[model samples]
Target chain A: MAILDVRDLNKSFGGLQAVKDVGFRVTAGSIKALIGPNGAGKTTLFNLISGVLSPDSGTILFGEMPVQGMKPHQIAEKGIARTFQHIRLFPKMTAIENIMIGRHTHSRAGFISGMLSLPGTWKEESRIRNRSREIMEFLGISSLAESESTSLAYGQQRIVELGRALACEPKLLLLDEPAAGLNMKETAEMADLITKVRDLGITVLLVEHDMSLVMNISDEVIVLSYGEKIADDVPLAIQKNAEVIRVYLGEADA
Target chain B: MTRNRHLQVFLLIAVIIATQLATMLTDTQHYLTQLTMSGYYALVIIGLCLLIGYAGQISLGHAGFFAIGGYTSAFLTTYDLSPVRDKAFIVLLSRMGLLVSTEDLYGGQVLHLHPWAAFLIAIICTIIIAYAVGGPVLKLKGHYLAMATLGFGTIVYKVVLGTEGLGAADGISDVPGFTLLPGSEVSGKLSQRITNYYIAWGLVIFGMVLLLNLVHSRVGRALRSIHGAEDAANAMGINTGRYKLNMFVISAVFAAIGGVFLTHYNGGIGPSEASIMKSVRYVAIVAVGGMANLWGALVMGSVLNFLSLRGYFGSYDDAVFGVILIIIMLFTPEGLLRRDLFSDIREVFGTGKDRGERA
Candidate 1:
């Protein structure tokens, strides 16, 4: 079953149509890659799915329920979480604290209980702390838990950002340019991590500039050019498609 | 952290007692009046610190909330109901024991709300105003947020200065004392000066404890996340807007409570209390305290307010605050008391041990 379905999605930025007539579906627990060159509306699509921008006209169904035009936090509560194309960690906080923020949806202790220092609030706090640690350990960054997030290395900061998203216990995880600034080794490890995340029952959706990373692990691939999708198929077919070669690979070669 | 926080509070309690004892031993009991007033102003400072530091929002209208509380209670308690005492609503309120009967200087019968009823009404009114103002004002960011709140403070100042029934520029005076117990009333009477000092500082300590607890909890973590990155926090399922709005209201309530008690303590409140300069002074204190440090805000709030209230800055009070605000903004927008600055200072003094420890 598709966990998310975007139907006839359309978005315009004044005179510029950023995304047009786009439709796609991601099956449960599968890794889907959204690949396109710059200005192909990949980030725009991610924003629409994450509710950063409402569609001009479209229906976004998550888990078969309409979620278009809802607030970002509301979409997240419905079990969709996404990281940024650029790193956006809470610079002043520790890595573990950054992850525990993801558990905000899971923890319900409010300002009153927190101020009163109620027993339930304490219990929930400890649980969130321990769970955040577990997520860091899962990402192999347990040793960096106490360091401030921004002070960490660039690759590790990316991992920390992914850990923050994972802490939300998302059903559908969106990764935008997860390997953009990484070296080859870090990119490979990120691909491994993405696979690990999918194996843990998450449905992974990603927009990546690195073709090798996309072709290495994606179960299915979707290609876009100038705000319109050009292909949707398995990795081998996407690599061999003539239309993709003309608009994507041909541009890359030049 | 828990033990350290309690230790800080205990230290504050010791300081409160020591200051009172020192004042009495030196025959300088008059200082208690300024100290008491300083405690109330510090209440407003710490609340502003929470909004500016944690919630990542700026509000210049807190003085408006303060004036709302002061003026509401002052108006309700001073407005005589004798002319309409026979009305069903007045009689009902009288029967409900919400009305107080006293005598003016001419010995005529006067009827009005008891201080307790007026105080409750004042707080409720502050909450209502805060929610209404905060909902729209918090949606703005950066300098726009500052401008909106400044406008709010100015409007309150104008309304209070021009309203005929609110005593205009003369403000409300001869307000009745708030009798919390048999002898412990919130008033400026010299006999009760020491009691009022403890009352005011005790409330400050209570507020500090509550705020400390809040900043260390899940809600506190969420607030920092919003401050650090609002859009990222929202994508992670944190309701940034609701948190910002609620924080605005909470801080406004703190300011209002300070206004209510301080008005009763001083036996009146003036339009100047709601002035934009007062609001700017508060923001200046919060900036000096370090944007996100509650403890720093408390200490700075207390010392600065005391100095100003005691006339240390003389006629240049607002100018002094304005200069401090400009300097902080120009050189240390992150605030003056951050941990890194302390570490740097220690290094300069050759007392550093944890150099490069943040790494």
Candidate 2:
């Protein structure tokens, strides 16, 4: 069954329709790559799906519920977690603290319980810490656990950001341009990390400009141009699809 | 989390007690007097510390709450009805279990109480008013928020100035002293002065401890996240509005507590107490201390208050405060305890090298 289903999702900024009739689906435990050139509305789609902005039209179903009008955070509670295009970790916080914040949605402790440091507060806190550490270790960034997020190198910050999203223990994870600034080695690590994330039985929907990473890991690839979905198929088919080349690669060559 | 906090508290209490004992033995009455005011100002400054340092929100109207607490206490205390007429409310509330007589409202049998009760009442009042005011004002960012809060301070000053019962333009006097505690024999000017010193210090410590715990808690983390990026914080499932509102209330509570002590410290209040200039003093204190560090806030609070009290630069103390704030903004930008400086110092001290190394 599809974990996330988007149908004719529409969003417009003034005169620019950032996302137009964009629809896609991800089967549970599969990696789906949404690829397009710059301003192809990939990031905008992420925002709508993540509920940062309400879509102008159409529907976003996470599991069985229509999640179109929910707040970004409410959507997060409903099991959709995301990372940003630019790394947006809480800069001054320690890495473990950053990941702990991601667990906030899952935390049953109310503000008073956390504030009062009640018995259950510490128990939940330790659980959060252990889980955060496990996610950090899983992403191979365990050693950076105590460091401040901003003090880390760019690649390491990216990994920690992933760990932060994973700490939420979401059913579906949306990654926006995770390979944006990585070098070849870092990108390879990112690919391995993405594979590891999928291995955890979580649905993955990602936006990337890196064709190598997209083709290597994505179970299905959807191509977009000017907010319109032009192609949807396996990575091999998307690689050969004429319109995918004509729009995305054509813009690249230009 | 609970490990060393109590030790920190004990050490703080020990330090305050030592200062009092030192003053008593050496009879450094002048220093004690100054520390009294310093203590109150420090409490208020620490309040700003939480607002500016952790929540990353700016306020230029803290003195408004300070004045509100002071004037409320002064007005209610000094207007003592004679026992015959004062017998009016006492009979009514006593039967109702409220047990409030006119005497209780206006000094009653307690020592610093008239002022103390007013201080408590004013703090509660200020929280309500601050919530009302801050809810909308906090939405505006940067200089706009500053300007809005400055206007609020000015408006408060004007209201205090216009209300003749609250000392009108001249200011209230004979504002009575603070009760050392509930129903204590700590009366008389000298005793009240000593009591005020300790009480002020106690409140300052309270503000610091409360803010420090807040900064380390999940709320603090959420506030920091919002400060870093509001949109991202929302994406992370934090209720930015609720967090900001909570911070506004917490900051107000701290300011109100400080104001309560301040009312007793001055034993009188005026429109000048809540003036825009006074609010500016608080922002300056926060900036000098360090925007993000609680200890920096406390240290800055003491240093700034001490310098002002000493009249260090020939009555240019306020000007000196303004200059220091400007210099920090222009040069340090990170205040006396810059976040970067801590890291650099930690590196030199050899404690933070490993923390930053693996990253």
Candidate 3:
């Protein structure tokens, strides 16, 4: 069964239709990649699914529940977490601290308990800290734990963001252009990481422009162009789809 | 990290204890009273630090909450309207040993509510008012939030100045001092300068401990996340709007508590207490201390307030504060303590390279 389902989603900013009649589905525990040219509204669709922007008219379902119209935090609480296309780590915080914030939903300690330094609050806090460190270790960035997030290298920052989203313990993860700016080696590592994430039983839905990375790691690829889905198929079929090829080549020609 | 926090906690306790001993050894009532006033300011400033430092929400009208607290206690303890005097609630309170009968200047019998009861009532009222105001006001970002708080402060100041029953521009006077134990033969008014000093500083210590613990907790991380990036914080399953409003209300409560105790200590509250200038002065203190640094705010708030009370700036208090604010913003916008100004000086002297390598 699909973990995420978007049906006939529509969104516009002013008169420019950013996402129009967009729809897709990601089966539970599968790796899905969304690939499109610059103006394809892939990020817009990601935003819609993550509840950053509401659709003008559509339904978003995470499992059996409708997620459209829910706030971003509400959607996150419903077991969906996302990383930004642009890195958005808390600049002044340590990398580990940034990831621990992702554990916010799972932790139950609140203002009063925190202020009093209750035993339970401390226990939960230590648990979160330990878990966050474990995540950093898994990402192979444990050495960067104490470093300021903004001071890290671009690839390291991307890994930190991924670690942060993973700390949410989401059933479904959305990665928005996770390898937008990286060398070939970094992109290869990111692809390996995405595969590792999917192997952990979390459904992965990612939007990327790098066709090589998408075709290599994605079990299914959804292609979008000019705010509409142009092709939805396996990576091999998407590579041969005439319309998807035309959109990419047309952008290259122009 | 745990060891560092423990050390900090130890240092904080030591500082509070040393301050207490110093006041006792000096035995100067006037200086003790001045320090006590600084303590009140410290309570409000510490709350402002949490609001500005962690939540990154600016409030320029905290003095309005302070005024509300002062006037609430002042009016309740001093004024005896005919309706309120005869109310069943008042009679019940008197029966319960919470209110006492006292003779007014006109030889009329008036029911005087216990100062402790009045203080609690003032805190409750301030919280309610803060909730109502913070809900909408906290939504505004940047200068808009500042402007809204400033307008709220001005409105409160105008209302206090125009209300006849509240003593108009002269403000309410003769607010009663609180007794620790009511309806007891040993209970006496907490009117001594030394007693007031300890009470004020003791509250400050409590506030500091609470704030320090909060900053190290889960909620504190959420607040810092919000400050770092509200959109990202919301995306991380944090209710950003709710947290912002909560901080705003909490900061207001702190200010109100300060106002209540200070009013009782001074025996009066004036319209100037609610002035916009006073609110700006608080924001200035927070900025001067360092935004997002709790201990820095406490130290700077108390020290600056103490200096001001000593008449060092005299009539130029506002002007001096403004200049300090401008200088801080221009030179070290991060905050005084947060910026390593000494390192920058060393760099200017061309010795920073060697020092940096050694470190």
- Indicate which candidate wins on DockQ: 3
Who is ahead in DockQ, 2 or 3? 3
- By TM-score, the candidates rank as 1, 3, 2
* Chain A TM-scores in order: 0.98, 0.96, 0.97
Candidate 1: which stretches are off by over 4 Å?
A251-254, B342-359
As a TM-score, model 2 comes out at: 0.88
| Tens-place lDDT digits, model 2, residues B250-300 | 777766666655665666666777888778778887887778777777777
Q: Candidate 1's residue-wise lDDT over A90-209, tens digit each?
A: 979999999999999999999899889899998999999999999999999999999999999999999999999999999999999999899999999999999999999999999998
Best of the candidates, lDDT: 1
> Each model's TM-score?
0.97, 0.88, 0.94
Residue A140 of model 1, lDDT score: 98
CAPRI verdict on model 3?
A: high
Q: Mind giving the per-residue lDDT tens digits that candidate 3 earns over A95-206?
A: 9999999999999888889888899998898899999999988888999999999999999999999999999999999999999998999999999998988999999999
Reference contacts recovered by each candidate, as fractions? 0.87, 0.49, 0.85
In candidate 2, list every pair of residues with a backbone clash.
B53-B291, B103-B108, B112-B178, B112-B179
Off by over 4 Å in 2: A108-116, A250-254, B1-7, B76-120, B177-188, B338-359
| RMSD (Cα, Å) of model 1 | 3.0
Count of backbone clashes, every candidate in sequence = 0, 4, 1
Error of 2 at A226 (Å): 0.9
